[model samples]
Target: MTPVSAPPIATASITGLVLAGGRGQRMGGADKGLQMLHGKPLAAHVLARLAPQVGVLSISANRNGDAYAALGAPWRAGVLADTLPGFPGPLAGLLAGLRAAQTEWLLTAPCDSPWLPADLAERLTHAALSARADIVTATTTNAAGEVSLHPVFALVRTSLADDLAAFLCAGERKVRAWYARHTAAEVAFADERAFYNINSLQELAELERA
Candidate 1:
């Protein structure tokens, strides 16, 4: 008998959030998400790739909400600001996304990773359902066969919003630490370049030139 595979998660059941709410110290304090890559904002590139993968789209921007909102206009995406002050980190953004999302799952990716895999949400959702995990993140293996975890590229249940809020209230800012508290699974992708995140103006230039 042929084994039946689990059905793919409905795109409408997941909300996508681009974590653009960073201090951008590496980019000389300039908003990293606003940095242009190939004549478009880096976050714009991310949003373009992410928008089709989920039912709703949102941006986690601490600055330049208007610009982000405009970028999101194509998808009618919501622009969210971190509830916790001082640009707490991606977890804060995750918290905001979780709270605002009407979907069962929230898929997150950093704004600077314009080349994020198109299959990110589908793969993560599959891993989450298979493992019965609360959170699922992406991983990649380097040329040397060293595995690296990309915790920021994750899918989490919106149900964890309260737990995340409490964790942030207690000053726990680490992303991996919060995931450790839950049942988390990791899905490996073959292409490492798909997850590349531009950190500085120099890196953006390098990527553009490449």
Candidate 2:
């Protein structure tokens, strides 16, 4: 796919949901989203991209509302119980985001992806609508020619809460597996670097260097 700008869409009509909770074991056990990058929290970068595009929004986190709350966006705690016992994962978080979402369209993204394109929400929404799909995923490339989807960076119908809730209850935690159960498209990123996900301290350090 050729790289292109993310022209705006119906920002006043959709909802933005930030996934802010993670075990962060890779960063030596801290809230990865709260980690400071350039003296600012990573969550700050996510909120900035999300706030201008959606009319309503919330953060889906676990264990620490106070810090998540300070971002000044309403927050939804991860419903660990919402997923099948012993299979807790991002599906549970998405369930919570979908439940709390108040718009027809819901945009979900993680807090640690700092360099996401400015028009991510709009482009994802556009892809979703054009495909006539229930969901649209953002995929980016790597130097090894591997293209991966940021499952968190998806545009879904808020009404799918029931479908998502049912999926989470079936002992399914893998996002791609759950996403496969629907008619979805992988929207390739023209600039693969934008889909980078920071999972470890070393990765974050490398990102800082870049």
Candidate 3:
């Protein structure tokens, strides 16, 4: 009898989701994902990095769906809108991702973080599987020994969709708070720059100059 080999991690059981549903108030209300970054949209950069790490891909955007849809075209990524209205928050985007993903796990990163680490999904999935956790989030330590949790960069089980939806319905918008209620693990990353997110136009300009 011939033995079969498992599929590569890139086409295994994970789906990548880029969170771009924010109001972008800090960017002067501009669509941050649509913003130009090195001649391409910011979300495009995120998708390019994330698409190869998962079996499927998606984008969470509240407005300008057409533009986001265009950015997702190369990957055949689904563009999801918040089922709940009023531009709630990233949690809303997460909920949409959890529901839309066809894979057992969903890996997420903010669209603004164009420099997100390429190993994000691999590391998080390894941690989650090893710890048998429902969620795995990325964390970074500063020179001063301060640990910062980047909750937006996370891997979650699709089975938690119901629980997340309930939490959102209870008016809970806090990502860490919701995470605390689940079996969560934190994976430390050495490169903090990989997680740096541009919040303002000035920051974008500075990064561009860099």
Candidate 4:
């Protein structure tokens, strides 16, 4: 896959946040982020990429603190922030991250997706800045160039937390639904394999081999 140049990644604009709060139901209800990918925990691999890109590294873990705390990064517990109808999910974690971020930009990736690109945070931030976007997300394609979107891989403004929280209160829970109301850029990863989230034990097994 050909890499597109992400607009200039000014180090001043972004803070990294890893969303780790999901209740991992598919992998037998275990903490999927805590599961080992190789020699290290899944979240650890994400932390390696995350801590380097932003001035601060924050983990959004809902129910487990010691489990996630041992990773040694600053952690924030996700609240039942979604006042929206049907129990809004990881958006709760995203809301927590945006609240904790002090920087102008917040770059986020799901904890279960450990193989996210090294320049992910930087690239997403650049994509947003370059397009004068409200938010920026990662996209990738297969050999045929069919685009796939990964909304969890995003760079957003800290200022949007209120809007997002308000959206939740208004009974809008889906991330894509809220994102549709804003200007967003999809920075293609150009490689579909790069953004897969290990939501199931089957995928975790595959990641171990990768």
- All candidates: TM-score: 0.95, 0.85, 0.93, 0.86
> Residues 142-195, candidate 1, lDDT per residue (tens digit)?
999999999999999999999999999998999999999999999999999999
Descending-lDDT candidate ranking: 1, 3, 4, 2
Candidate 2 clashing pairs? none
lDDT for position 151 in model 4: 90
Put down candidate 4 lDDT per residue, 1-210, tens digits, no spaces: 665343365545677777777668888988777888888888888887676666767777765667777786353322223223333576777787788677788888888777678777667776776799989988887887677889988888888989888887777669898888888888877656568777888878886786
Displacement of residue 175 (Cα, Å) in model 3 is 0.6
Candidate 3 local lDDT, 1-210, one digit each (tens): 443233234456888889999999999999999988788989999988787787878999999998888875667558999999999999999999999888888889999999898778777877887898999999999999999999999998899999999999999999999999999999999999999998999988887787
Q: After superposing candidate 4, which stretches have Cα over 4 Å from the reference? A: 1-9, 73-87
lDDT of 2 by residue, 130-178 (tens): 8887888888778898877678888888788898877766666788888
User: Which residue pairs collide in model 4, if any?
Assistant: none
Candidate 1: worst-modelled 10 consecutive residues by lDDT: 1-10
Query: What local lDDT does model 3 show for residue 64?
Result: 94
Which candidate leads the pack in TM-score? 1
How displaced is residue 101 in candidate 1, in Å? 0.3
Ten contiguous residues with the weakest lDDT in model 2:
75-84
In terms of TM-score, which candidate is stronger, 1 or 3?
A: 1
lDDT of each: 0.90, 0.73, 0.88, 0.74
